[model samples]
Target: MSDSRSGLFGFVLNGLGHMFRGGLLYWAWLALLLVLIVLGGWHYYLQLRDGLLVTNMSNQVSWGFYISNFTFLVGVAAAAVMLVVPAYIFNRKDIKDVVLMGDTMAIGAVAMAILFVVVDLGRPDRFWHLIPFIGRFNFPESMLAWDVIVLNGYLLLNFGISFYIVYNHYQGKEPNASRYFPWVLLAIFWAISIHTVTAFLYSANSARPYWHNALLAPRFIASAFASGPALMAIGLQIIRRVSDYPIRQSVIDHLALVAAIALQVTLFFVLAELFTDFYNEGEHAASARYLFFGLDGHTALTPWIWTAVLLLAVALLILMIHPLRTHPVYMNIAFVLTVVGVWIEKGMGLVIPAFVPTPIGEIYEYAPSATEIMVSLGIWAIGLLLFTLLAKAALPVQCSFLREKAHREVTHDDA
Candidate 1:
């Protein structure tokens, strides 16, 4: 028993060792992320010191860039289900090999989502009030309580599952399927709930006519499916180029197909929403107008939304066409455009519009102050750095250990 415990401890130490052993380019990349983090950290300090006054968020638009990012990342974190469903439930071996990457991405994304929420709060130190058992958590009543539970639960689920698999791989053994499969199933459902609950949070706001619609949750899920897998596909391409990992082209193709279909569904939802809003041309339509064309003369978000629409439209065209989708160049282009388009649409387009022409019919155009932008940039850098370190450590255990295990099985069979 003591030897077994020591072996597990040693394995952890070895993984930590991998985090610091990369080449000059890898180190340079780490340095760049660190610099950005420092700059962001410095700005965040300023915001904390001066209060949210440093940001452009006001009573007219209470939730600004921070919540916008938090909302989008919730979908990104939940989108891991896209990969999880196919890899585990359908038993796709190619995708299963790299699904750990999706889990790792979820961990980073959820962490970032949580950080965005923290920064949005006026008194972040009071965050424990949201803790159900310890604090004054309103759980079962407060949607924020539900969000806290799901985001943290989802983060732990991914971390636990990844650790189990990677630890087993390091031990030169296959993870017992029965032991982990049930948890994988739970993670899949939990992933969906995370985003669904987030959507409900918005839709529950009856005062905000822009968000008080039945279609919000489905729209969230659809856009999440497009953005999350699209982002993962980009990461996989990078991993393929940079490492000796045996990521198959088929895996990338599968992700592209998922993103393409999801993008189509997302666009349809957007069209449905637009038609519903403009058909009546009432007070509720005001927010949609501000988003797409602008409300009254305040056109702050008009250019941004149009740009997102154009990017998504072109991306859909590229991905839907057989030749373009198959070509690596075009496929990558579509993936990049899909990610950026969804970020703008789901982040700025969704969040800001709801508050615009506020319920009392006040017009205050809110933009992210330089401070908000810097803090957001810093938070993003932190997530990227976390992912980089995690992938650096886990990839060898995942790729090399599994490959060696497979090789031994084949050799024994031949003998």
Candidate 2:
């Protein structure tokens, strides 16, 4: 037992060593992320010193870029379910090879999501108030409390599962499925719950009629499915090119198919929502009007919403067509489009619109100030940096495990 523990410790140290060693481009990438982090950290310091006045948020439109990003990232984190479901439940060998990347992504994304929430708080010091026993933690009633639970719970689940699998791989042993399979099942359901709870956080706001719809949760899930797989597909291709990890074309193709179908469902939801809002335009339709078109000459988000629509439309066209979806170049193009389009639609288009024509019948146009932009970029850079390091460390161990498995299989065949 002592020797085994020592071996595991050594394996971890070796993985850490590999994380720090890389080529010039890899170092440059890390350097760029560091620079962005510094710039963002500097701007965040300014915001902390001066308060939210440094941001464009106000009484009329309180949730701005920070919450927008938090909302989108929750979906990205939840999207890991796409990979997990196939790899474990259906037992797809191709997907199993790269599912660790999905877990890594969820870790980075949830970290960012939590960071965004922390930064958005006017008093970051008072965050302990959300703690269960130590803080107020009005659970079962407050949706924010629920959000706190699901997000943290989901994060812990992924971290525990990933650590188990990665540690086993590093020790040159296959993880026993029975030991971890139940957790995988829970993580899958927990993934869906995280996003659903997030949506409920917004929809529970009875004052915001725009977000107070039953459809919001389903819309969140659909859009999440689209964006999450699109991102994983892109990451899988990059890993295939950069490492000897044996990420199969079948995995990429599977992810693309999921993204395409989810994109269709997402577009349908959007259309249905538009019709519901416009078919009998009235007081409730005010927010929709302010978003897509101009309301009382306040056209700030009009162009932005239309631009998002155009991007999603174009991406949908590209992804839905079979030939284009199968073509590597066109498929990648569609993936990029889907990510950006969903980012804009779910981020700016969703969060900002609901607050446009405030409850008091006053319109306030809001945009992220330079400080908000810089801080947001910094948070994003932090997530990317975390993912880069985690992937760098885990990929080598994964590759080694695959080689060992192949050898064992050949040996068994010969015997």
- Tens-digit lDDT string for candidate 1 (1-415): 1356438788778778999998898999999999999999999999889999999999999999999899889988998887889899898988889999999999999999999999999999888777767889887898988998999999999999999999888877789999999999999999999999999999999999999999999999999999999999999899888888889999999989999999999999999999999987899899999988887889999999999999999999999999999899999999999999999999999999999999999999988999999999999999999999999999988888767868898999999
Q: Which consecutive 10 residues in model 2 have the weakest lDDT in total? A: 1-10
- Candidate 2 regions with alpha-carbon error over 4 angstroms: 1-6
Worst 10-residue lDDT window, candidate 1: 1-10
Please give the clash total of every predicted structure, in order. Answer: 0, 0
* Candidate achieving the largest lDDT: 1
lDDT of all predictions, in order shown? Answer: 0.92, 0.91
Per-residue lDDT of 308 in model 2: 78
Query: What is the overall TM-score of model 1 with all chains considered together?
Result: 0.98
Tens-place lDDT digits, model 2, residues 5-88: 538677678778888999898899999999999999999999999999999999999999999999999999999999999999
How many residue pairs in model 2 have overlapping backbones?
0
The pairs that clash in candidate 2 are: none
lDDT of 2: 0.91
